[model samples]
Target chain A: AQTVTQSQPEMSVQEAETVTLSCTYDTSESDYYLFWYKQPPSRQMILVIRQEAYKQQNATENRFSVNFQKAAKSFSLKISDSQLGDAAMYFCAYMEGGTSYGKLTFGQGTILTVHP
Target chain B: EPEVTQTPSHQVTQMGQEVILRCVPISNHLYFYWYRQILGQKVEFLVSFYNNEISEKSEIFDDQFSVERPDGSNFTLKIRSTKLEDSAMYFCASRAFFGANVLTFGAGSRLTVL
Candidate 1:
């Protein structure tokens, strides 16, 4: 079984600043995918960014990027130029890659607060 | 943009009563799933349906729970006898047959069992 852990329960960043949310996972499988999802007060899960284990290069999506260290089993999300809209509960998720698919194991979550 | 739709954004029911949550996935999606999140916990997968049958289910999906795609567009999850602990937000998601396994989720239906 794979388990994702988000050590920080809460994080705050000043507007226009950068913030990094930490995440770590324990999985024996060599092939897998890591994802960061955001849930606003409305509770809608939105995809932030994703990283494939095979890719040594980190994945970047606009202001959102991931620092994926496969050897350390760590995948952290970085939000640059944080805005008020970035305030939400961020979750780190893990999914099996190979033949199996779709079931996502999520972390406890980190509540992000973007201060103006 | 295409999105997953779920009905009864909020539902209130008494313990021991039956409750059904409905969702309409993307038109072209081939896989459907049900997940839930307690007040402050992480989202947990309940079940996944493919080809009109359940392909995967977690232990949380017990005998009391059931899922059906009764028609061409609706996917529903029924809790035979709800309990107070069942109060949570239920999310419906769908994925296209071909993709990086990205799932689009609905806004979620908040169930309050008293």
Candidate 2:
């Protein structure tokens, strides 16, 4: 079974600054997908960005980006120019490749606090 | 972009009662799923539905739980007997057949079994 681990349970960042949330995974499958999801206090989960294992370039969505190291089994999310709206419970997820049913394995989550 | 929508944002039911959580997945998406989050725990996958059938299910989806897509737009999850342990936020998600495996999720429905 594949498992995703988010070591940082809580993180804080000042407005307009940058912060990184760390994530790691255990999977034997050579091909897979990684994603970062943001759940606000309202409890709506929103997709932040995604990275494909086969791609060497990291994924970026505006101020959100990922540092994906496949060989190291690490996928970390970077939030630049952080705004108060970026505050949320962030989750790292993993999914198997090739004919996947879209079932996701999620991490414990990291609570990000962005200070103004 | 289209979004998945769920009904009864919050449900309070007594134990042993049957409760059905409903969802309307994105119209064109082919894959649908149900996941739950127990209070402070990580979100867990319960079941996945595709082509009007269950593609896969987790151990947590016991016989007490079942899913249905009665109409073209409505996908429902029915729990035969609710327990206090079943109190959690139930989320419905869907994804298109061709994408980066991106699953669009609905605002979860909080089910509280008393």
Candidate 3:
């Protein structure tokens, strides 16, 4: 079974600054996917960014990016130019390749507070 | 952009009562999934449905829980007998295909079991 771990339960970043949320996972499979999801107080889970295990290059989407270290089994999310809207509970998730398909195992989550 | 939608944004039910959460996944998507997050907890995968049958399920999805795509657009998760522990936010998601692994999630349905 694959397990994703987000060590930080709470994090805070000043507006317009950068923040990084750590994530690590245990998986024996060579092929897999890592993801970061954001849940605002509104309770909607939104995909922040995703990284494919096979891709050595990290994934970046606007202010959201991932530092994916496959060898270390680490996939961390970096939010640059953070804004107040970025305040939310961030979750790290993992999905094993093959027949398991779309099933995801998620971490407990890191609550991010973007201070103005 | 297309997005998944879920009905009954909030549901309150008594313990031992049946509850059904409904979702309408993105059109043209082939894979559908259900996930739940307890208060202040991680989002846990419940079940995945594809090709009109269950592709995968987690330990949390016990005999008391079942999923059905009764029609083309509606996917439903039914709890035969709800328990207080069953209270959580249920989210429905869908992906265009498996290789991409990009899932679009709907605004969750908050279920409160009394």
TM-score of chain B of 2: 0.97
- The number of the candidate with the highest DockQ is 3
Ranking by DockQ: 3, 2, 1
* Candidate 3 lDDT over residue span B5-99, tens digit each: 99899999999999999999998899999999999889999999998999888899999999999999999999999999999999999999857
Model 1: runs farther than 4 Å from truth?
none
Sorted into a CAPRI-style docking class, model 3 comes out as: high
Predicted candidate 1 versus true structure: per-residue lDDT over B47-108, tens digit per residue: 99999999899999999999999999999999999999999999999989845568899999
- Off-target runs (Cα >4 Å) in candidate 2 are B98-100
RMSD of each: 0.9, 1.0, 0.9
* DockQ score for model 1: 0.84
Q: How do the residues A1-116 of candidate 1 rate in per-residue lDDT, one tens digit apiece?
A: 88999999999999999999999999999988899999999999999998888899999999999999999999999999999999999999998975458889999999999999
Worst 10 residues of 3 chain B by lDDT: B95-104
lDDT of 3 by residue, A18-112 (tens): 99999999999998999999999998988888888889899999999999989899999999999999999999999888788678899999999
Q: Residue B114 lDDT in model 2?
A: 96
